[model samples]
Target: MSILLIILTIILPPLAVFLQHGLGKDFLINVLLTALGWLPGVIHAFYVNKR
Candidate 1:
């Protein structure tokens, strides 16, 4: 993951993952995680983006 992506993920988790992976399972998961809690979404976004 790029620095910008990491920064974006911190600010907006779902948007960061969506920009990287688009509308897919990872994106959906991030969205749900984001809805549930900010920290989970950030963690999931980092993991997903790295993968």
Candidate 2:
């Protein structure tokens, strides 16, 4: 599940964030980051590692 989230993050950051954390700050952040730059979005989306 986590691996899929990470992969989704790389492809579509906002969707990945939504899947992991639902519709909240992270989703907003992902959208902003995706607008700013694709790489940043990916990084932020995968920032939440289940550690």
Candidate 3:
């Protein structure tokens, strides 16, 4: 599950964040980061990974 989430994070950060933490702070942050920079969003999404 963690591996899958990580992969998803790499591919699509917002979706990965939404899957991990739902439509909360992390999700909002992921979207913001994605808008600011793609790599940052990927990193943030991976950081939010529960497992």
Q: Residue-wise lDDT of candidate 1 within 1-51, one digit each (tens)?
A: 678888999999999988988999999999999999999999998898888
Q: What is candidate 1's CA lDDT for residue 26?
A: 94
User: What's the distance in Å from true for residue 8, model 2?
Assistant: 0.8
Per-residue C-alpha lDDT of model 2 across residues 1-51, encoded as one tens digit per residue: 567776777888898778778898878988999999999988877775342
lDDT of 3 by residue, 1-51 (tens): 568877888999999888767899889988999999999998888778854
| Local distance difference test, candidate 3 | 0.85
Instruction: List the candidates ranked by TM-score, beginning with the highest.
Output: 1, 3, 2
TM-score of each: 0.91, 0.82, 0.84
In model 1, pairs of residues that clash are none
Which prediction has the highest TM-score against the true structure? 1
The true-versus-predicted C-alpha distance at residue 6 of model 2, in Å, is 2.2
The lowest-lDDT stretch of 10 consecutive residues in candidate 3 is 42-51
